[model samples]
Target: MDNLATTWVGATAKQISRAVRRGDTTATQVVADHLEQIAISDPALTAFRVVRGGEAIVEAEKVDDQEDLANLPLAGVPVAVKENTAVAGLPTWHGSAAARTAVAEEDHEVVRRLRGAGAVVVGVTRMPEMGLWATTDGADGPTRNPWSLDRTPGGSSGGSAAAVAAGLVPIAQGNDGLGSIRIPAACCGLVGLKPGRDVIPCDLGVDNWLGLAENGILATTVADAALGFSVLAGRSPAKLTPPDRLRVGVALRSPVQGVRADEPNRDAVATAAKLLGQAGHDTVTAEPPYTTGVRIAGLLTWFAAAYREAQASGLDLKTLQPRTRRHVRLGKMAWNRGWVRQEQRDAWRAKSLAFFEEKNIDVLLTPALATTPPPADGHSGGSWRHNLIENIRYAPYAGPWNIAGLPAIVVPIGLRPDGLPVGVQFVGKPDSELLLLSIAGVLEVANPWTRHAFV
Candidate 1:
C-alpha cells in the first residue's frame, strides 16, 4: 500500500511550510509523511537514534492550533536533532554506552531556538561514541548510506545525513567538531555547512572553551540550509552579493603530511575550480598555511575535551569503550600540558588568522575528504589506537577548519564512477559565512544534483 503521505518526503522545508501555512496541507499531514517515511526507511538506514512520532504529532497539532503563521517561518517542518544535543524528553547519551540513558530535563539552547522558529523536532539522530569516529556506528548500530547499504553514511552526524538523503526529513540539525556534519553531507550527497565559531548556541550554555565545535544544518538545498541558519542564528544571513572576479584558492593536497587525496577527490577539486572560473572567479592553486604546532595543539585540545566528557560520565573507565578510556587518559595528560603549550596554541591561532586576513583570497577550495566514504565496517575493527590513525588517513582535510574556528562548507560536486558522491570544500575567513554561502549558492545552481537520495 502506497502511503499518500510519502509524497511530501521530497518536499523542501520551505515548500512544506508554504503548503501548510496556505492551508493546502495541514501540519499534521506533513509530520505524518515524515514519520511514515522514517518508519519505512530507517530500518535499512539506521539513521535515527530516537524517533518521536507521537510527540511530533502533538507538536504539529499545536502548530495547527496557532492562529499566526507570520512568526513561524518553519511551521510544522519536521527536523532531526543529533543525539548528542539535548531535547528535553530525549536521551542525550551521545552514542556512549557508559553515559546516562535518561531523557533530558530541558532542551539545549539550539533546540530551543529551532522550536521557537516553528520547526518540529521529529527525532534524535545517531552518532559514534562521543563522536570519536567518522562513521556513524555506535552502541545502537552503523548508519548505512541510502545510495549504498554496504557503505557508511559518515559521522558523527551520519544519521542526520542519512535521514535527509533518504528523504525522511527535509532538514536535520548536526554539530561539527571535526567534520561531523560536512563529512557526512559529502558522503551522502547533501549540503552541509559548519557555521562560524559560536554562530549556533552550544548545548552547555556559552561554555565552549575550545570553540572547535558548532551546531549546523544538513539539508538538500542551499536555501533550506540558509533558512535553518537564519532560524538557529536568530538573524538573517548576509545579503551581500559575491564580488565579481572573486579570488578563489584551489587546494588539492591534504594538510596532513604523507596523506594524499585519491584521484576522484583530486578530480572533484579540479572540477570545482573550473566551475568557479566559469563563474568569474580568479582560481589559483594554493596550499594551506601550516604551522608545525597547530596539529599538536589541536590533538591536545581534543583529548582534553574527551577527558572531561569521560570524567563527567561518572561510569567506571572499564565500562566505557577502549577509545574513550584512552582519550580520557590522554586528555588528562594534555590538560596538564596545556599550561606550557597554551602559548603555542595561541600562536597557531594567530597564524590561522593571519592566513585569512593577510592573504587576499576570498575562498579556499579543497577536497572535502581524502576519499569517498570508505567501507562501512573498514577502519573500525582494529584497536582504538589503530582506528584513530585510520580515521586521520581518511579525513585529513576536516580538522584544520575546526581548529582555526573558521567557517567551511561542503557541497557535492559530482559522483565517482562507482556512483558514490564526491564533494569539494569551501573554507572562508572568520564570520565570512554569508559570502561563502553566496558563492556556494551560485555553484549549486550551475550544477544541480538530485535533491533526493539517488536510491
Candidate 2:
C-alpha cells in the first residue's frame, strides 16, 4: 500500500502494533520492511548472528491469519533475542563458534512469552563469548555502536542495542548480569531496564550468574521498554502514568575505587537532576554504600559465572578466546576458595535497600557509565589484562546494582562532547520496575533525545 506510511522501520512497538491491529497494514508487510532494513544495515553493525528472514515472514503471515487480534499486546512487532537465549531450531551462539550450543528444541521462556504476546522473532543478536566482557565482539567481528562506528555498543548485550539504535528492531531482549543491558543502552542512546531479581524468570546458563542476572528489555522509547517488560514478565500491558513527586538521591561517585565518571558522564547526571527538579522532584547528593567487600564479592561472582557457564556447557576452555579462558581460570580459583557466596550478595542487597530508607529517598540516580564506551576494535583478540582494564575503567557503575538485585534503568540524557550518547542510571527499591519506567518516561518527555541513530 503505497498510500500508507512508506516504511515501518523506525516505528515504536506500540505504533506498529496499533497499525497492524487497526487493519492499516498487514503484519507481513511490517516484517518484510524490517527484514529489508536488517539486510541493508546489519552487515555494517554485525548486530545479528542470524536473521530469520523466511521464518519471520511466515510467522507474520500467521499473525495476520488469526481471526482476532484483540488480546495481542505486541501484535506484528519485530523483535530480536539476545544470542545467548534459546530460539527453537537455531543453535544458541553464545558469542562465538567455540561457545555455540546445539539447536534449541523449544524457545526459552522469555521467547515463548514474546511470541505469545504476538511479537515475531526476526533474529538473534550477537554478544561477547560467554558474555564475559563489557565490550561486544568475537571471532566474527565487533558489534559497533550505531551512534559512532568506531566506539563500542557496550555489551554483552551490544548487538541487541545496536539493532534497536539503528531501527532494525523496535525492541530487543537482553539479560543483565553485570550491566550488560544498561551499558549498551547507554552507549547507543536507548532505554534499558533491568528488573529486580526473580521478577522475570531467568533460567539462563548455570544459575543466571549466581542470581545477579535478570532478563530485561532494551528499546528506543520508555513505553516500548515497558511493553516488552510486561510481555516478558507475563503481565498485561499497562499504560505508564506520570509518577508522583519523588525524593531522588543523586550520586556522582563511581562504584569502583579507581574509576570515576568522566566530565561528560558527570554532566549527564547533572542534566538528569535538572530535569527531575523541573518535574517537581527533589534531588539530593547521596551515595549508595558500595563497600570494599561488596566490590570484591561482585567481581568474584562475575568470574565464577564465567566458569559455571563454560563448565556446565562442557566447552573446552582452551578453545575459548584468550581473555575468556583467563576469566574461566580465575572463576575456578574463586569457586575453589568459596569466594562467590550468596550471603555476600544478600548482604549488599540489604545494605543497598537500607540506604534508601536511611536517606529517606524514593529513587537513586547515578551516571550510567564511568566514561565513554571503549573502542570497538581488537577487543576480542586483546590480552586478558587489557580487556579487563578497559572494561572496568568505562563500566564500573552498573555491577553494584546487579549485586544488590535492585531494579535499575538507564535513560539517555544527551550526547557527549565527542558525539557519543551518554545516559544516567536510576535504581529503586524492590518491585519498583514500573516506578522506574514512569521516571524514565518523564525524562523522555522533558528532554527528548534523538530516537534513532542517524546511521
Candidate 3:
C-alpha cells in the first residue's frame, strides 16, 4: 500500500469515491490502507468483530476493472456494517453467542445496494446482544469510546460509532430499533441518521418484528452521511444544500418520566436551539407527542422482539448472556400481553405524525442523549434490572424518535468539560429526511466539528 494513501483514513466518503473515480488512488489501495488502519487501531478500540480483507480486495479489484466509475457514487469508499445486519459470507453475529454462527446466504437489501454503488465492505462492527441495550458490551467485550477509552461508545451500534469516530472507516452502517444508531453517534461525536419508516427498507434480508428498527449510516460529516444514505437507499447521492428557514421546536424533556437529563446534556439542547435561532430558523420549546404509556408499549415490543430472536436462533439458553436471558424472560412475559403487535406500532407512528402536523413544526431539536457515554465498564456484566435502569438513564432522548418512526439525525454540538462530545438531535416527520439533511448540512458548516480524534 502507498504510504501517502494512508491519508485516505481522513477523507470523507465523497472525497474518497471521487479520488478513486478520478484515478488518484486505486480501490485496492484504499481498501488495503483502511484494513491496515483497522489492524493498527481496532485492537485497542474493539470496534469491529470481523475484517473481510480478502473479500474487500476482490470487490475493490472489480471496481478497478470497471471502465466507467462515474456511475458509482461510492466507487471505492470503505464502509463497516453493524454485525447485526446480514452481509453475504459473514456471520450476522448479533453480539451474542446465542446468535447462530452461520454465514448469511445473501446481503441485506441495504447492503446489496451499497455493493451496487461500488463501495467496499471492510468488516462487521459490534453491538449489544440481540441489540437490546444502549452500551456496546457483549460476549466479546465492551467497545470503548475513541475520545476516552474509559467511556463507552454507546450501543447497540457502538462498534460502528467507535470505528467512524476513530477514523477506522469513513462510514459505518448501523441500525436503530430504539436509538441504537443515534445514541452511538452522539457518544462518538459523529453524524448518525435513522431515516423515517419505509424511507429506507428495514426488513430486507432479516426477519424483524415491530418494524421499529431501520438501517442508517455513521459518518464524520453530514455530507458523508447523506452520500452513504443515498447509496444504501438506492437514490442518487446529491449535495445537501441549505434548507429554508425552518420552524424548529426544542424539547429538553426526557421521554421517560423519572429519567431527567443531566445539566450538560440539557445545555446541549439549549445551545443547539440557540444556534438554530441564530441561523434564522423559528425556535420554540415542544415536547414529544406520545405518552409515557406509548413509550412503555414500544419498549416492551422491542424487548419481545429480542426474546423471539433468541428463541429462533436455537442456541442453548446457557450460552446466552445472563442479561440477555433475563431480557428474554421479561420479553416473553411482555409478549403475553398481546400489545407488541403491528397495529399498536402503527398507531404510535400515526400519533407522532399527527403531533408534527398539529404543531406545524418543520423539525424538532432535542438532546441526543441524557448524559455523555457512561463508564465503559459501567453497565457491563450487570444484572438485567441494573442494565435496564442504567441504559434508560443514559439515553433518555433517543427512543421516542424510533417510537415515532421519524427521520432523526444527531450532530455534535461541541464537547463537555470532561472532553467527551455532546450531540443534539433534529427530528423530522416521516419522509422528511431531505429536509433534516439540509438543515444538518447547514449546521455542519456553521459549527464545523473536528473530524479526527487524537491519534
Candidate 4:
C-alpha cells in the first residue's frame, strides 16, 4: 500500500479512481489530500464559496466501505459543484448572498449522479451575480485566475475553472449559459465540454437561459472530462477512440460584430487546425451563418434569462448587485417586448446544423476566446455596460453554439504570448458528444498542453 500521507492533489481523476479501486490508497486519504490543498490554495483564489471539509471526508469513507468498486467510474474522486447548483444541506448561492435560495433538501440530478459514481463533493464554487457576466466576482471577492491572479479565469464557471486549474479538485461541474465553461477553460488551460441541449438535465433558472444554458464538465485532461460527462449523461463510461478522417470547418471570424480574434487567439485556431491535419483530418475555411436576427435575438434572450431568474427566485431587484440589477431590468424590457422568441432560436439551430451539411464538414473549429480575460476584481461592483462590453469583446465564440443547442468542447492548444493559456472550440452536430470528445482527445495527444497552472 502507498503511504496514506502521500498527497494526491495533482493526480487526475482517472488516476485517483484506479488507485482507490486497486486498494493502493483509501478514498479518505485522497479526499483529505484534496481538502488540505483547497485549504492552502483556495484562500488566494476564492474559488470555493464553501468547502465541504467534514462532509466530504465522510462521503469518501462511504466509497471506501463499498464491497464492490468495479462499476464506479469516478471512484473516490473529489469534485466541486458550481455555486448555483444544489448540493443538499447547502443553500444554493446563485453567485451572491442576495441571490441565494433555500437549503436544498435533496441533491440536484447531476449532483446525485456524481455521488452515485463514487465521487465526493468537496464544495460549490462561486460566480458572478445571477451569472450575468463573463468575469466571476461577487461581494465576497473575485475568483482570481490560477494562471495569473490579475486576470479572471472566465465566468460564470470561473470558480470551477480556477479550482480545477489549481489542482484543488480533479474536475468540477459548471453550467454554460453563454461562454461560461469554455471561456474559463481557455483562460485556465483545461478541457471544458458543454453538451448539446437536453443531453443532460439542466433545470436551472427559469427556462435555462431560454434553452441556451446546459451543464458541462471542466477538467485538466480529456479522459477526466469524458468520465465526468458520461456520469452526468447517465451512460456507461466508454474509452475515447481516435475518429476516422473527417472534414473539419475552420473559421477565424468572431461571431459578434466589431469583435475579432486577436493574433494569439487566431493563431490558436491555426494551431488547432494544423494539429487536426497531422491527425489525418481535412481542414477548410467555413463560416457559420451568424445572421443579424440570430445575433440580436440571442442577445435579447440572454437579457430575458436574467429577468426571469430574478422573478422566479423572488430576489428583490434592489438588493441585487448594481450590474445584475441593470441586467434584470433590461431582461424585463426584453421579455415585455417579446423579442426572445422560440421560433427565432429554432431557426438559428436549424441554420447552424445546415451549415455542416452544406459545407460537408463533420465539425467546426473556431477560437475559444477573442482576447485575454478581463481584470478580475473591478468588474464585480463596476458598471454593467463595462461588464457587458468586456465580456462580449473577449468571449464571442461560445455563445452562438449555446444558442444553436449543439455540443461544443474547448481544448487548450498552448499558452498565449501574455503568459495566459489559449484554447480553440470545436462545435459538432446534435448527438455528437462522443465525437467532440474524440476530436479533443486527438489534439490533446498530438500537441500536449500544461495540465494545471503553477499556482
TM-score per prediction, in order, is 0.95, 0.98, 0.96, 0.98
Q: Which residue pairs show backbone clashes in model 1?
A: none
Residue lDDT tens for model 4, 1-455? 12122469889999999999999998999999988888778888999999999999999999999999999999999999999999999999989889988999999999999999999999999988888888999887899999899999999999999999999999999999988899899989999999999999999978888899999999999999999999999999979999999999999988888999999999999999998998899999999989889889878999899999998878898898888899889989999988778999999999998999999999999999999988888987898898889988999999888889999999999999999999999999999999999999999999998897746
The Cα error of candidate 1 at residue 356, in Å, is 2.4
lDDT of 3 by residue, 371-442 (tens): 768888746478988988888888977777776678899998888889999888999977888788788877
As for TM-score, the candidate ahead, 1 or 2, is: 2
TM-score of candidate 1 to 2 decimals: 0.95
Model 2 TM-score relative to the real fold? 0.98
lDDT for model 4, on a 0 to 1 scale? 0.92
lDDT of each: 0.81, 0.93, 0.84, 0.92
After superposition, candidate 4 runs with Cα above 4 Å error: 1-6
lDDT ranking from best candidate downward: 2, 4, 3, 1
Give candidate 4's total backbone clashes: 0
Tens-digit lDDT track for model 2 on 392-413? Answer: 9999989999999999999999
On the 0 to 100 scale, the lDDT of residue 30 in model 3 is 90
- Measured by TM-score, how close is model 3 to the native structure? 0.96
